[model samples]
Target: MINSVLMLLIASALSSSALAKSCPEVLDSTQRKLNAVEQVNLCDEFQGKVLLVVNTASQCGFTGQFEQLEQLHKKYQDQGFAVVGFPSNDFNQDRGSEEKTAKVCYLDFGVTFPMMARSSIKGAKANPVFTEIARQSGVVPRWNFYKYVIDREGNVVGTFASSTSPVSQDITSVIENNL
Candidate 1:
């Protein structure tokens, strides 16, 4: 009961979006396609907030996780956190082009948070941002929807498997304490 009350208090305390914050020191100067938006300034786009980066795929069974991700993003957004999606075609055949894939995600899921371009999240061609995520989290995503949680200070605090939901206790704890 005390834990639940504490959670409520923390959630209430963090009641504003950090999306507009000045870009932090961690994000790089990389421009990638955002859902329907043309090349957006990545770092400038999401400067001050805590971030949850997930490698997503359209055809995967784990695709249903989008709803949970959206929930987490929406619930914690006012608290300075975001769920950033990276649609990848790396495994078991990804459907649609990069833009089309992102479109499907937005239209189907009402994903309000940032969704970046499709990229290889594994092997030799993985994007530098992801490589950095992996290097810090100490876990290369084995498949799509693998989550890397970045704290407000830009530390890669944790990595979760594809099986882990965005609302998982571990993830929630990280956001509550680190964000």
Candidate 2:
């Protein structure tokens, strides 16, 4: 019985490893939650979903976009859509701590989407996800709240500038068309 159990465990481990390897390399990245403690594998969590990714700052002029973003998440979530927010301090406008950023986003704006921990979102210091986003879209974020629309296949389909509102037809149309 002990020998049988050992073989079963070994097979289970190998099966898990193979399952993990099936996730594509593009979305195979771990990101910290807004609280800065828990981390999640993006591919494991969001591989098959259409994603609207935004680099956001609490104190920036574009901060109000969070409400519209939340609305988008609510409206399209059941249709395999998600809004992923990345809080960034690269613009010197973020609250400087996860707690305060959480308050601004979760409390003030009622943002229910997944918000990643604060990180640099520009230049060489940008996170690997943003790097690949820029590479695919040919448009790097010029300021806080610039958005990248990613399709279900993990393709960066569009990049919207900071001036674009989250609920604008230009943004939502692309999201609907992709969905």
Q: State residue 7's C-alpha deviation in candidate 2, in Å.
A: 24
The TM-score values for the models, in the order shown, are 0.80, 0.86
**Model 1 over residues 14-86: C-alpha lDDT tens digits?**
6533443545444774646654456766677676678898988888899889999999998999888898888
Q: Highest TM-score among the candidates is held by which one?
A: 2
Q: Per-residue lDDT tens digits of candidate 2, residues 1-179?
A: 99999999999999998875576544768999998689989998898889999999999999999999999999999999999999998888996678999999999999999999888887888888898888887888889999988998788988899999999999999999999
RMSD of each: 11.0, 5.5
CA lDDT of every candidate? 0.79, 0.90
Task: Score residue 68 of candidate 1 by CA lDDT.
Answer: 95
How much is 128 displaced in model 1, in angstroms? Answer: 1.2
Q: In model 1, where do residues sit more than 4 Å from their true spots?
A: 1-26, 35-37
Q: Which stretches of candidate 2 lie over 4 Å from their true place?
A: 1-26
